[model samples]
Target: MFERFTKPARAAVVQSQVEARRLGHDRIDDSHLLLGVLAQEAGVGARVLTELGVGLDAARDAVAALHAPDAQALGALGIDLDEVRRKAEAAFGEGALERRFARRRGFFRRSTGHIAFTRPAKAALEDALRQALTLRHNYIGTEHLVLGLLTGGSSTAGRVLHRLGVRVDAAELRRRVLDELGRAA
Candidate 1:
């Protein structure tokens, strides 16, 4: 299946891993996949999403906002999240929490080479293949990936898109993609 990916598609996949790592995630999820597609500024997927007002930086900020600690919820437990972060950073320097997991134990040891995909992410990839097949395409491209992310119901990407004000459904996004393809052709 990977062999069927075009260069753009493969780059998106790689970019997803880079996003996951940047966000300190143990696995890549649909949100990361969305980021991957959006990172491709020239890809049809990115162009369609941008037209819908979802750009890469904004999407990344949304994803980070979603994963950030719930200060309001923590307040109910009498915890001051901001104070804790400030104190921790002051005590150990900035990015102290991040350094804990990212630190290398030995001179030769480093972070793992691979980060696995979450179930939903794997499902999205599977759906990308299905999308390509549905479109009668010989290979999976970045556009198919965007379609898969949109159709992966209740996915993190869906939530991120919602936050980014992308109200279009999968069908709508698909139409836009086709239109873009037609223009390119």
Candidate 2:
């Protein structure tokens, strides 16, 4: 399922798997993949996601919704929830978030053919993943990616978010969700 990815995209997938394992997770969920992409810091997908308002917490919510069990009381609704998830996954894969940044960065490299993400971008991606895991989310989504871009701060993605007016506060959103869950419980 992952063969269509380029070298950097493949790296993102590998990074996502590593992150999932580090977090003791067993599956390569979308959120984990999102985190993996962001880990590259300079990938086209991460930059595009950051440009959008999506962040780690919002991504978590979306993924959590996907993970939520179907309501037994909604039997009459007759909705194919699995199909919905599959569609969402397909959409995510087709989006700009799945592209590699390595090719983009390669344009500026010296003759040695060595290029790396700026430090801030790398940190931003790591922070995004940490924030997502801290919230106990099983999958990485667009939001986490946005948060990583913001946290990575001062990159093209971060600048794009500022231009788009997306807030970069993952913790606040997490707290609010927890509060809501507490109330529901």
Candidate 3:
């Protein structure tokens, strides 16, 4: 199945793990896959997302927003998340508390290496192959990857893309990607 992936598609898969690590996530979810798609600037999926104003940084920020720690939930445990956030911000500057793993001294304690892909992520990759087959494409490309994200409808990546697209919902994005592929063909 990997043999069917094009260069850009393979890059997206590898980069998904990189994005997960950068975001302090142990698992690569569909959102990370979306970042992988956005990272491939020359790929059609990347270009289409960029045209819709969804760049890599913006996508990263969205991922961060989605994964923000729940202060109320933490407060229930008597942790006083707000106070911790304030002190951490004062000592480490802004957004220090927002990160998943905190650094002690110079070392990050969390496992920064070997990120596993979540079930949804694996499903998306499998769906990418299905998308390529449906389109009668010889190789799976980044465009198919974008379609794979949308196939799940309520997936993390689909929701993020829809939110990022603003006026254009996930379905619209799916259409635009397919249309762009058609034009390139």
Q: Candidate 2, residues 1-185: lDDT per residue as tens digits?
A: 22323566568757756654544344444455555665665555555554445554454344444434675534458766556556867876543322323334547322222223345545655665665576575544334444554554355444433444556464554454344435544
Report the Cα lDDT for residue 156, model 2: 45
Taking the candidates one at a time, how many backbone clashes does each contain? 0, 9, 0
Give stretches of model 2 more than 4 Å off. 1-114, 138-143, 152-156, 164-185
Query: Quick one: best lDDT, which candidate?
Result: 1
* Candidate 1 Cα errors over 4 Å, as ranges: 86-94, 100-110
Write the candidate numbers in order of decreasing TM-score: 1, 3, 2
Model 1 CA lDDT for position 56: 92
Provide the lowest-lDDT 10-residue window in model 1: 100-109
Q: What is the lDDT of residue 124 in candidate 1?
A: 96
Candidate 2 has an lDDT of 0.50
What lDDT score goes with residue 55 in model 2? Answer: 59
lDDT of each residue in 1-185, candidate 1, tens digit only? 99999888899999999998898886799999999999988888888888899989999999988887899999999999889989999998998666424344655333577888999999999999999999999999889999998886899999999998889877888899999889878
TM-score per model over all chains: 0.88, 0.32, 0.78
